[model samples]
Target chain A: IAGITQAPTSQILAAGRRMTLRCTQDMRHNAMYWYRQDLGLGLRLIHYSNTAGTTGKGEVPDGYSVSRANTDDFPLTLASAVPSQTSVYFCASSRGTGELFFGEGSRLTVL
Target chain B: GESVGLHLPTLSVQEGDNSIINCAYSNSASDYFIWYKQESGKGPQFIIDIRSNMDKRQGQRVTVLLNKTVKHLSLQIAATQPGDSAVYFCAERATDSWGKFQFGAGTQVVVTP
Candidate 1:
């Protein structure tokens, strides 16, 4: 059903470069989220959107930004990628209040 | 910030045996808790969930127990198989918050055949 899909399965970026990770859902969910997973650590929220055009900062949102122009798409951007930002990024979406459906993931490596 | 963490970082169990993974949460106001399983290179997948109003919930061969008094949560997998070997995480969502989920450090399960 292609519940969720993320582009650029993996990428390597030079330090200080800008990059955007794409996320999309076909379930028409109203809520979308961005999280990063590091070794020995749990998934930390980066940014989330409860609905289109609305965004909120999460637990770790200092170096990341997200935009939800519509219900089907939410994109996360890294203005200046750094080595610390190298981690596996995940995108998730949920219908009003149900369980969240996550995308495969995007592996980002900053060098 | 509220914190959720797992008591054990790794667990090893023999096939056909039951395995239990534990998680402790610090937020007393959290109303909904969920368990997710993540394979080597994939996103977290939902396994089971329980709400504050309930103490236990079961799905397939998995069961989730919630102890609000101690703010502890656990996931029990029956008849552990090799496929069940993966990292498990517990996440909590506040009752009034939308799209906000706090995840605990995961416990990696290894099944020996």
Candidate 2:
């Protein structure tokens, strides 16, 4: 069903470089979210979009940004990535209610 | 408004034994809860869910219990197997929010032979 698709399954980037993690959902969900999972820590929300044309900041939204131009795509951008940004990034979508569907995840390594 | 465990914990169990995973939530307004299982190199998959009104729910060989008074939630797996080895997470949804969920650090389960 390809519930959710993420690009660049894994990546390695140098500090100060820019990177964007792409997320797409075929479920036509109204809401999408970006989260980073760190070792020994839980998944922290980075950014979220309630619907197309609207976005909201989450707990850990400092080094990242997201855009929702349509119902199917939400991309997270890291402008000048830092070493601390090294973690696994996950994309999720929901009907704007409760349950969520997640992507396989994108592992990012910043050196 | 959202809080999760600061560190991940591991639980080990012998095959065929029952496994219990626990989680705690702080927000009293949170009325919906869910459990997810994540395997190596994979996304978190839904296991079971429970709302505030109910104290317990059961699925195929799995059970979820909710205790609103204590703000604690638990997942019980019967007949643990090697395939059950994974990281389990608990997420709670606050009332009237835009489907926002707060996730716990997660508990890693290791099933031994």
The top-ranked prediction according to lDDT is 2
lDDT of 2 by residue, B32-75 (tens): 99999999899999999999999999999999999999999999
Per-residue lDDT tens digits for candidate 2, residues A1-111, read 869999889999999999999999999899999989986777889999999999999999998989999999999999999999999999999986869899999999999
Residue-wise C-alpha lDDT for candidate 1, range B2-113, written one tens digit per residue? 9875354789999999999999999998999999999989989999989999999999999999999999999999999999999999999888776688899899999999
TM-score of 1: 0.95
Clashing pairs in 1: none
The candidate 2 chain B region of ten consecutive residues with least summed lDDT is B1-10
User: What's the residue-level lDDT of B2 in candidate 2?
Assistant: 90
Q: Per-residue CA lDDT of candidate 1, range A38-77, in tens? A: 8767899889888899999988999898888899999999
**What fraction of the true interface contacts does model 1 reproduce?**
0.62
Candidate 2 residues lying further than 4 Å off, grouped into runs, are: B1-7
Q: For model 2, what is the C-alpha lDDT against the true structure?
A: 0.93
The pairs that clash in candidate 2 are: none
C-alpha local distance difference test of each model: 0.92, 0.93
Native contacts, share recovered per candidate: 0.62, 0.66
